[model samples]
Target: MFLNKNRFFSNTDLIGFALLALLIFVMLPVGLDVFRLNLFGKYLTYAFVAIGLVLCWGAGGILSLGQGVFFGLGGYCMAMFLKLEASSPEATKIQSTPGIPDFMDWNQIAEIPFWWQPFHSLTFSLVAVIIIPVIFAFIIGVAMFRRRVGGVYFAIITQAIAAILTILIIGQQGYTGGVNGITDLRTLKGWDIRTDDAKVILYFVNGGLLFACLFIAQIIRKSKLGRILIAMRDQEDRVRFSGYDVANFKIFVFCAGAAFAAVGGAMFTLQVGFMSPSFVGIVPSIEMVIFCAVGGRLSIIGAVYGALLVNLAKTTFSELFPELWLLGLGGLFIAVVLAFPNGLAGIYKDYVEPRIALIFKRKMHIDEDVSKYDPLEAAAD
Candidate 1:
């Protein structure tokens, strides 16, 4: 059991964590150019959603298809702050409204909206990034889970919510920046984020955030709560009959997942420099699920790799064969489901891990034999 003793991480987990740390912190940064590194940083943002999904869907069996909504909410909150900073009176002197965002001016809004006012303060915006999404998730979780909603029905409801939110943003062009989203994000507290140095710095920052989320996921996975979640997933009726409030457990993990996704969304906006309604829509939400599925939903670290590899492939294939990109993505998902149902981590465990372990075992045996035959040990004997 992953919940054995008080160990938060087993031997395999330590190796996974160390290797991921090396790859994300050292190898990738050292190898890739700033542009490609920044791209991976964006990919890492999705990994946050995947990690949360590992807890929500993998453990708690709470599948949320509208995760992109939380992600977008976080990104928009950050974007609002950045946009406000960039929309200074001095900077937008030529506009009709010299102090407000350009989109507001273009849409004939003479003054800043009251809701946008709070975003001027970076602290408020940063806090809102997490809080706003968590609040949304909490509301949804409570409304659905309390009523015994789960599985496909819950997923559909979330998906519908994502669509509705997307439509609302698109309709409220003046407020939400419509389909184009909040763009021209320039600085973070007067520091220009467009520079190469800032991009690299942000990439490392993104990597750090990812590991933080991963650690939290691992804690939950190894704790009693994690075991409970698993039991609830497999035998919900029995667990509920045992005096546990299944709905409450589901809500907790779901909200936690939303919070993780929101953080990712905020980091994404900081790195990518924009937040659009397109990202808040159903398609992106489903893609986020695909990221989790491909990575091995049961494994937190594997989800990170899944996010990176899938996004990397998307970038590569989209540029090379634009027409076939969607098909390829769909096909990949099908293959993962049909063949390697457990995703990349499952593949590693089933085939790759055993071979590696066998080689290590052989090496250990050889070392023992050599030590026993050593001239010094033999003479002593």
Candidate 2:
């Protein structure tokens, strides 16, 4: 009887595990196709942004509109390193000539900017991907949280930051690669990105990273810190009066989300082999919020599903009906909000899981009440 109960519980977990495995198996074949693989890779990168937004906005109750800032920081840092590495050694020797970069040449820059000096090494660039975003978030989070600035004010401030960053990158053409951004990346660690093997490896890496993010988010959600975050979300004043430092908690999660966004940005740079200023603009940041909302703002799985679905639709519509793609997307968003305000993930939780569980239970005769024959409860057996 104990064994039977154990099996029943294991079966429940098994179904979820099996579904996840099936998803990975199916994606593998799709990712085998070079074009499809690249597109999926981009989806994973966007999912990363969605995950960060879910944590900050969904759990922490902090609606951050400037995740793009960190995303851009990491992308630009990686792009700068790749650009420097790909540059001809002869180009490096010219200190005062127009050998800084093509955009710099157009801007009449005779030398590399002082700030662009550290991006020469791939290692430094990788470190900066995480460090720069975390540091920036720390400063910004402290400043705003300490002063108790939030709600629409916080959102507007973050949006302004994103706008300013975009303009700065566009204006500083010499150092930032200007409006064109950075491109023409050839190799990553001696592996040709154009080759099939490299593409496959990147696909798996992206998949693994997405799973890791989900797992970590799950752990955080189950932790005490997560509870506090949720409490602050529901009632900040109550949480504060309960002797908790709400600002510190908000800052911690905000920085964590920023770091995750940076990771996504770096991964995106690797897959696309380019970074552009447009990626960190206000529009993209707002889109991140929409992605989370459409996915189920509070659920990590919902975020991933939403990112993949939205991007897939984007790809399909762009190819099939280029002119109407944006309209189609807008209509889809409205439909989701009106039909299922909780998003796709919520729909699954409400309508799908229960049916699945019922089917499984019926198939396994779970409701048969075999306990009626329990030997332990038998009289003088």
On lDDT, the leading prediction is 1
lDDT of 1 by residue, 1-381 (tens): 324334777677899999999999999999999998999999999999999998998888888999999999999999999999999999999998798899999999999889999998989998999999999999999999999989999999999999999999999999989999999999999899999999999999899889899999888888789989988988999999999999999999998999999999999999999999998899999999999989987788889999998999999999999999999998988998899767888777767866676677697774433232233311111
Point out the worst 10-residue segment of candidate 2 by lDDT.
Answer: 372-381
Work out the TM-score per prediction. 0.94, 0.87
Best by TM-score: 1
Q: How high a TM-score does candidate 2 get? A: 0.87
CA lDDT of each prediction against the hidden true structure: 0.89, 0.77
Candidate 2 lDDT by residue in tens digits, 1-381: 546433422343345445654575465455457777777778778888888888888888899899889888877777777776655456445544534665665667767777878987778889999899999999999999999998788899999999999999998777788888987766665566767677667777877777787667766665678778888888999999999999999999898888878888888887888899988999888877777878887777688778878888888889999999989878877877788765776676666766676776789988855343443412111
Q: Model 2: clashing residue pairs?
A: none
